[model samples]
Target: MAHETSETTAASSVDAAASSGRRFLRNKVPEVTVSFWIIKVLCTTVGKTAADLLGEKAGHGLTGVSVLMSVLLAVVLVVQFRTTAYRAGVYWSAVALISVVGTLISDSLTDGMGVPLETSATVFAIMLAAVYVVWYRRERTLSIHSIDTTGRESFYWLAVLLTISLSSATGDLVSERMDFGYWLSAVLFALLIAAIALAHFALDLDAVWSFWIAYVLTRPLGASFGDYLSQPTDDGGLGLGTVVTSVLFLGVVLGLVVYPAVTRKDVTQLHQAARQAA
Candidate 1:
């Protein structure tokens, strides 16, 4: 009886380990790293500049650009959802496109619909909060590390969409409506992100909350930075034009994402057998 029980327990352990490994493999997001943040900031910057390029510079008008980008974002999101694991190319592509689409959503509220940036920011904040409430209630956790199911992934993307919109509105409110200008606004957001990082490392802030806060702040910081570089000198920018700024940032993001994809360096690692045994 002891011998039989031992064999059964070993089989159970093996099965649990395999199940844990499968769960890890199914996670749809990359492991957070320094490269992740760099690529994210660049993606946000490209989001701002590329939206401007299409809407104003390309003569597509805001409505046209919004529609076009929304469709593209939807397509990319479908691909993202279908993937069983995180593919750097697909994941970052979705992020970049969503950034543009999110910017367009905010701009549409402000410019097309005559909504004040303050009002848009407030609404988006409420919506983001609601998403969190629902997500946590359903999943019992908001950690990105647990994004291994379609339902969790849905919540994650919805939260991301709101964050992007909220960030755009907040950035515009500070930089344009409040007369802070682009560069100064970038500095302010950068400082805020740094403070969050400090709190996480030194003050023992919750890791998940720290990550989300930094994620939200990066959107505005990158947007302000992009605007500062692309807007004309008279508008407190270097006058590089949106085209130049978008292309430059996109190139950097592509290179960074490609390296990780090739090397799998940023792939989340899990000691599945140990975890399962525990």
Candidate 2:
């Protein structure tokens, strides 16, 4: 009876370990929530203004700023990947840095390399589509909720970078090439996001597609909004300046991130439980 009991306990321990391993895999990313969207938009706004502040205002120029931000982004992502579970600070830091890097990439193509914004947007869209195809083929899903392994997380970040680049290029194309202006461009992207939400809630749009589409739109919306606040009034903005605008949005982001970090509100319940168990 004692030997049988020991065998059963060992078997149970193995099963528990396996369960914990699976849970750990899935906890690397946060759950989607309203706070997620709010922070994402705010981060994009800060991305736009901060990049401008460094590249244009602070005299680093686009090339120097891009190199600096890209290096910083890579470091943050390394920390992000090393973590075992969802951490608001690390994850959002990666997002914010990627946003700046993505914007700089689009800007470099347009202003530095003399590529048209329309062409950049089209090329980025193709790249994004290719990433999606490869990701889905390899992982069998494009849903963020399934970012359970390093491979998935790698794909997720790549898709995110592409989306930000595509959105920046598309926003510039619409606002500059089409002459929509900052305010109108912001409104246009905002409405498109609202439409996506409506379709998801009312018309049964696939949640994954809706989330990805809205995610792409949010960057441009935030960028336009940031430009409207940061540019001079003569240029149709409020004259807040990029420094002020970036600081303001980043402050709000800090405040919002603190709440989730303290409460772990953004971490899924299963993730929290698994983390505690581990």
Q: Candidate 2 residues 1-278, lDDT tens each?
A: 00111334434544575766743454576667788888999999999998888887657778988998999999999999998778889999999999999999999999999998879999999999999999999988777655668999999999999999999999988877898999999999999999988988789788788889999999999999999999999888999999899999999999999998898778754454445555
> For residues 157-225, could you state the per-residue lDDT of candidate 1 as single tens digits?
999999999999999999998999999999999999999888887897887889999999999999999
Deviation in Å, model 1, residue 214 alpha carbon:
0.6
lDDT of each: 0.86, 0.85
Q: Cα RMSD (Å) per model?
A: 7.0, 7.6
The window of 10 residues in a row where model 2 has the poorest summed lDDT is 1-10
- List the lowest-lDDT window of 10 residues for candidate 1: 1-10
Please give the clash total of every predicted structure, in order: 0, 0
Error of 2 at 121 (Å): 0.3
Off by over 4 Å in 2: 1-23, 269-278
